[model samples]
Every structure is written in C-alpha cells, then in structure tokens.
Target: MSEKVVLHYFNGRGKMESIRWLLAAAGVEFKEEFLTKREHYVKLLDDGALMFQQVPLVEIDGMQLVQSRAIMNYIAGKYNLYGKDLKERALIDMYTEGIIDLLDIIMLWTIETPENKQKQLSNIEQKAKERFLPVFEKGLANSDFLVGNQLSRADVHLLEATLTLQEIFPTILSTFPKIQAFQERMKALPRISKFLQPGSARKPPTDEVYVKTVKEVFSHIFK
Candidate 1:
C-alpha cells in the first residue's frame, strides 16, 4: 500500500523540519504544503477540515496527525528509527525530550512581544544555559550521537533543534563547544547535509528576525 504524508509547515524550518528530515530519511514520498503565517495555516486547516490548531500537522492516508514530535514518533516507529533495543529507545526519548525543553525556552523569547522579550531572554539565560546546557553538553560528550552511535530519531531531532540555535542561541552553544561541534557533525551527515544546502526552506520572517535579535542580545549578556 502506498502512504501519503502531507506536512503543513511555514516557510522556514521549525518543528516540521525534523519530520521532513525523517520522511526523507525513510525514503517516504510526501508533499510539503508550506503556509505563510499562522492565519494561512489556520485557513488550511479550515479548508481541509483539519481539527488541529497548529501547523506541522501530517496527514497520512485518510488520518490526520497533530503536533510535530508526535508525527516524528509515529513515522519513526513505522520505520524502526527508534532503535532495536528497549534501552536504546528509552535513550532516544531522553535526548528528544531534552531537545524539546531547549526549544521551549528558545521559543519563549521568539514568541513573546518586543517589550517583554528581553525579560524572557533573561529567564532562558538564567535557567536554561546555566542549568541545562552543561548537562546536555555532558551527554553529547558521552556519545558521538545523542543516544547510540547509530543515527536514531533522537539524533535527527537534536540536529533539527540545534539548527534553531543559529537563530536563537548561537553564543550559548559557543560557550559549550561540544554541543557546537555536535551540531556541525549532524549537519555533516549525508541525509542532513541535503537540508543544509543553500536555499533550503526557512522559518517565517517574524520568527526568524525575532529569534536572531534575541540571540544577539543573549550573546552579549551571557558572554
């Protein structure tokens, strides 16, 4: 049976990009339905009779799947990307959740209003970088990949999550060289390298610019 995967994403990379990468990795044929803004995405849902409030929802066959990581987990399970061993699968979840936490902190700065943006940055700086980066840095040092040495879904999610840093916390990763190198290493993977090519899709302008400015401010304060 042929499976159809429709990925609802914005212009640039975000949650959906990792799912895109997973589909590519699994050699799955899917359509990329890029939306412009939150409104455009909402309209698509309305037109398609989609019940989800978010973009990055995947429609497989006749069923709709909401949430980016949920899509990733579903596809990964189908493709056996979760690893062969139970312990390895648990480790994959460990790394993927860690990346998700990092994303939440980073998004707080990007999604907040300009007047209160700095305050959000300060909170992420005080809490995330100081508290979490070290632990993640140690994890990266423990293994070449996030979970196992093999390319699991955890590495794929981590790679996609780290890309956000270039626009969200560039300097934070600079302080933790291991994580920085891990980002580079993931990009070097042949499958991931495909997405790193110039002119690859990007996140929306609002998110891109806001995250870039937040990273700049955080760099100065953290340094």
Candidate 2:
C-alpha cells in the first residue's frame, strides 16, 4: 500500500485511461509512463513486462497487471469500490460491462480516416443515445449510486464513459439529466476533482498524432 501505482500507455486516452480514472477515484496515487515511440513499447515487450504483449500495463501491489478489465477489478476490490456482497457485486459488474461496451465504440474512432471520422462519430452518438445512455439513466433514476447506496467502480466507469462521449459532442448528455447530475456529483469528489483539473494525468481525446504513434508502435496489428 505504501508503493505508488505505475501505469504504462500512450500519451493519449486509450484503455489505460479508464484505469487512470479508477485509480484516481480510489484515491491511489499513480505515475504514468507514456509510450512515446516504438522503442518504449519494444523495451517493455523485451523485458517481459507485458503479459499479453499489450500496453495499459500496470504495476501495483508487486504485480504487473494487464487487461483493463482485470486491472480495474483489482483496483475496485482493493479500494472497496466493489459492493459488499456477492449479489451487489454482480449488479455492479452488469452495469460496468455495459459502460465498457459503449467505450469500445469510442475507441474505434481513433482509427477512423479523416473522411470517416464524422460518420463514425455519428454512429457512436447513435449507439450512446439509443443503446447505452438510456440504461444508465434508468439505473440512476432513484439513487445516487448505480448498484447500491454507495459509490462503486460502476459509478466511476459510467462517469468516465459519458465524459469521453461528451468530448466529441458537448450536448450528448443534455437529454439525460440524471446522468448529467451523476457526472457532476462524481466530479465533485475531492480526489476526482483533482484528477479533472488541467495538467493532470487525464489525457485528452486521441488525435491524429496519437493515432499515428499507436499504429507505428503496433504496426503489426493495425495492418
């Protein structure tokens, strides 16, 4: 508990970003190492730091964790952001998974060609409105938290996912007042408020430069 968490990823918001959100909300201090070039990634691969040869790798509690979901689960449990009992945990899992599915569509935007970005962004908005946001809006209808009477990882993920969408379309959440309120409430937390400030570890939306860097770093897959 004394050692700080270490996160590895690109300079932009990729999968590691959600991990950053979870850590910040958990009040755990973390240091981020941005992958600036192919060599940074290659070094980790050669050092056996990445379990599945991927980024978003985290070092915490003397372990090198990979996979965003797994890393999140560990952080949630450690920080008591997971619910108290099995049933509550199951509910939290359900809501968290749904939020992640929506986030997946946002990730697809980074690979979009210049001509396709707007079309792809429209598609993302459609899914967020029709499929995802409504679910959270309903889940949060009568309570401050999603699964239980307290804040959990599900709440944090919901907030992060909505914020990411709003980055592209500022009015995306205007129709969902409940989620809008929930987003503000989460941001007001002392730790979370700090993370949202300028010059924090929170990365901006991926841009052309970030896309090019990622493809260059992992050219084998983007092909």
Leading candidate by lDDT: 2
Query: Per-residue lDDT tens digits of candidate 2, residues 1-223?
Result: 3267888898888888889998898888888788888899999999999989987899999999998999999999999999999999999999999988888888887778878877797788898999999999999999999988999999999989988888888999989999999988999999989999999888888888998989999988879
> What's the C-alpha lDDT at position 85 in model 1?
89
Instruction: Give per-residue CA lDDT, model 1, range 76-138, as digits (tens).
Output: 898878987889999888778887787766755565677888777668766656766777688
lDDT of each: 0.69, 0.90
Candidate 2: clashing pairs of residues: none
TM-score of each: 0.75, 0.95
**Weakest 10 consecutive residues of candidate 2 by summed lDDT:** 1-10
What is the C-alpha local distance difference test score of candidate 1?
0.69
- Where model 2 places Cα greater than 4 Å from the true spot, the runs are none
lDDT of 2: 0.90
Model 2 — TM-score against the truth?
Answer: 0.95
